[model samples]
Target: MNNAIGNSMYVVIAGAGHVGAHIAEALLEQGHSVAVIESDMKRFENIEAMDVLAIHGNAASPKNLADAGINSANMLVAVTGSDETNIIACVIGKSKGCKTIARLRSPDYLREGVGTGNLDVFGMDLVVSPDVVTANHISRSLLLPSLVESGELSEGQSLIIELRLSEGNPTLRRMLGSIQLPPGAIICSVSRNGQLLLPERVGPLELGDRIILVLDSRMLVANVETAFGVTKGGGTAVGGRLETGIDKIVIVGATKTGIQVAKKLENEKAMIVMDTNTERCQHARDVLEKAIVIHGDATDSALFIDEGLGDASVLVATTKNTDFNMLSCLLAKKRGVTRTMAIVDEPELKLLFEQIGVDMAVSPRMMTVDFILQNILGKQISSTQTTLHGSGITVLEVLVKDTLWMVGKEFGNIKFPRGAFVGSVIRGGKAIKPTRFDTIMPGDRIIMMAPQDSLHKVEKLFSYHSGTWRFR
Candidate 1:
């Protein structure tokens, strides 16, 4: 049976933890029918308050899957703490003819699916690892220190970045059309005083205006920074040069997240990992070749000096302990570390950490939720949609089809919905900065940004033809 809400799917989530609850809430907001199964009584009770079929039982049990309405579920997401339980739930859901996604933490299980291009491993249509996802986020931030937020588009060939205009920015007083941006970069939208302004409507940029930019991934981060007039010296700059110039990198905690971060960066920089547990340090040493592992209290101020954290270019705290991670980053910053990042357990603390001097604060749960939501909705909507942090704007990457109404039409002729801005068009494997005169062609991948409310209108323009909806 189809949901009364248009284009809505029935989704069964196995787990009531942070990731599962967030997923349920997001789906509900999108008008999808949802159900959640949780073994923990407290967690189950908490999720039951939502408008979902809350089944309190082990998600791995077949009876529990049936109780959660797996028979009619369009999707089943298993995000419990136990990897095996998640996998089993996915298998059960898959048998019931539902698309399944599992969140696995073990590297062994992740390697079997993620990056292999075969997400169907263990009967799961998609597999996501929060620790690995969070590690990748931290690695990208460390590698490209200037980006406030970033995501890949056009299959990783293009990148979308958000940067807040700061004082002394060269482009601060320039009209949106007059700024000298990099060759492949296009300013998608500007967030000014809580309003999202399209490029055509934006005036001269002011300090504190957050600008979203879509560009070729190969463009230098330094150039982007220079275009915005971000200086190199003071801690005021949000990002650093693309070349990184990072000589030494220190990671606190030898946990899975920390180890993954070190693993991604060890080959490029002088890597050092510290943890309070000697056993964990030994484990890190055994697995990581280029990293130097040390057992020490990260919160201890003496350890920072003793390990020469003062000379380090970037310090990342990845422990499970939020207090420890915050303390470690703060201490490292005090000792003169150029950049400090922390893995935040609570999403609310991300801003607090940044305000208190942490250069970046990443939440694994949020990252996992984003990944899952993108994958699930991307299939149903025929487009990739991601929301820019704190901005009511969402970036959508849509494939131009021959049946689209705008096909062969100049962008200037198309009456796009208000608050919608087409950023770039990818055709013939190259990203093009589209002008009003550019012609929309079939097979072209159009990247655009629009307000949440305007998304449906934007989609209708592209997906409707001859008074009928033809979604591709």
Candidate 2:
């Protein structure tokens, strides 16, 4: 039995900022008792108003951990702004017999022979770097064709693709069940008019609805786009020409994310970086082998025009300020950059920025939560991935056991639980787009989506144990 299953854990979280606050709320919603410690009194008040047990104090202080009931807590997550404080808090939490996780931004702590795997010596069970997670997500998003935001689904073998509906597509304005998608394609989540939906039996998809699709192989993505006319440059229903793969990449901001993006793309494309801070720009120039560094404000139209932003194939805004990132993307789009991406820290801004024409909006806070949750909830069924914006829907992969009654049974023979359905199946290294007549064989790898609450039910349905294999 999993340690966290059935038992509601006492989870103590340090820091009430964007990442920490969101994690606490999610843990509470999952039936865990949560207490948050924030040094900033104003932030503490904000979190306290949300019904959480918010304490105002230094998390690194033993007295604060005691006040939060660390002695009785099952887990302690330190996501404070200062890495030193987070490390110290974990050390204290460990001494109290709590499982500890620390969230750090600097890579120094993760370097070899440094703070890497040796974290166990310091009482930290896991060290999560949001910067690395955000960087990887941004890199994957850049590789997506037609400007879609893509994430790893099924341990990087499958993908969660976010596509905006283009006009006059056959897949639009029809109930999901009515549409015939390509093999291995599943429409799992929909973001329509600012509402996030886990469509169990969803209605017709609307024009401009941002939909997320799970594909066994990303190669099938172009087929869906072609069938639906969805493209980054628009034109189908969005009313703009489709943008192609990027060649010239322009990044605004010299923060760690910007530097990481520049380094990732420098070898394959012509990279240019712009930042207001001269010292950071110089450091980025020195660190990146071939990237061109420009000392200028991203929000300044004059700077962009002088830099010929219009000629760039892709523009990425990585500044910490959400408003600045939006403005920079707008300027880039106005200057004829076909694709624009922004680094947005807040989840609420993701849809808003996309609505205003930003092609992609990556969030560090959301990335951090997905990592923390996956760690807290160990892999049992298979690998799980968060769809766009950390929507409650998750794509999972599991092996079908021969002992299960459903094995060798037609897909129609089983009734999937609410908010869940099989998306794809892999057998003998070949991917299959499952149909009602398709029979599930033992040892097949099946991909499915379900709400977090329904995951256990889904898992039970796929278990090989004769007791669990029976139809409910």
Candidate 3:
């Protein structure tokens, strides 16, 4: 039933929603041969024409699948608006002898699929639930400073980690070889300033050097805290790790996302939520259950002092008002909070968080974009995050695929876009801030951060790769 023709594997996407388009864009940009088969004719016309092959058709029907050439297609991702359409598309793709992936939005499928009798009946490779992925990312990112990135692989046998050297980081100006990586950790790449860099044997790591590493599952949180210069000791940085944690956290807003932030924590950290609305603050209190909710202004210094806001380990400002969130986080930082988080939705005000001294600025919109890109795109883009200031940097957690042309090269040999830096690498379960000695491997997950304008240059890291990445 699957009769598709292409020089190599072709990916067929069966939806044109926000997430589907994002996936298509990424695949097209990363040079993947993707045929988007959207049922909506009007929406199909709106799909961006930047080098992607767009075929308007319905994959839900068997006839349509045959017409769309599903026989030779490698992978089929069903992400249409209707769950029935997605499942039907997957079933047809499987019948055509192609690997199948379906976006299962219902939590029922997520909970019952594995043990629930019949998911294996179809040729399902991976089933993604957006809420689960989004919640997981949000919880993890909320726990650490913006400088460190972490990922899980192989059920704990291996990991991918990224570290960004900030202006005030204690590891600044140190020789790459001098710092000892954790046991079972390997460094992958170093992003210095905004360039993907390969440091010399004697090169010293200055502030703002970004490092990506892979580590063994046994690594503890205390070790991570120590490695990243956190005041607290021994706990890992994944889900459920921070709840048993004994640090204090203050969230300066009572929005829905703020509630999500609190729900993610499973630790004993004292949480105080502050908001201007009496009812909203009360709702935050009731919803958090374990947190102390204060109905007061976040910008008020006296209130901050009285509530011990400055003494918290982390301060998260998730107010809808970007300006207020940034300012509140700055206030907390000045009061000596160790870590801070702020949610800013505006792309234009990206610089405000940095200028205002917030430790990290998060945008749900951008994160949602990355989440949508995960399933529809063929490229192995694990996750994407952007860091502010220091020349408009962006970090992409991309799986190294065989189609990449720049594979098996040392960091120093890779040509980065001007103003881009290749910081450090995570290899074999350890962090290696490479001194121009490390090499890229097949299974390696590379974390590269570069200037916002230099993303095109960063893509050159895979100049010869076939899979497309719709980079933002």
lDDT of candidate 3 at residue 286, scale 0 to 100: 67
The per-prediction CA RMSD against the true structure, in angstroms, equals 5.1, 6.3, 7.1
lDDT of 3 by residue, 1-472 (tens): 3333222346778887666776676666655577777778777887645455566776587766666567777777777877778888888888777777777666456553221122655556666654445445556755544434455543235555566655555566777666765665655456565455544532777766666555555344445546655446423243323312327777777776666567667355566777899888877766676877888998898988887777677787877788788878777778877677777766456556655566566665455555445533433544444453334656555566666665678867876777665544556544445555577777565656566677655764553354443221
Worst 10 residues of 1 by lDDT: 463-472
What TM-score, computed on C-alpha atoms, does each candidate reach? 0.79, 0.74, 0.64
lDDT of 2 by residue, 153-185 (tens): 545676667776656565777776765678777
* lDDT (0 to 1) per candidate: 0.76, 0.73, 0.62
Model 2 clash number? 5
Best by TM-score: 1
Q: Which lDDT tens digits does candidate 1 get at residues 242-353?
A: 3233678898899888888888888988999998898999899999999998888767778767877788888889899999899888877777786788888997787678
Better model by lDDT: candidate 1 vs candidate 2: 1
Give the clash count for each candidate: 2, 5, 57
Tell me how far the alpha carbon of residue 293 in candidate 1 is from the true structure, in angstroms, after superposition.
Answer: 1.5
| Model 3 poorest ten-residue lDDT run | 234-243
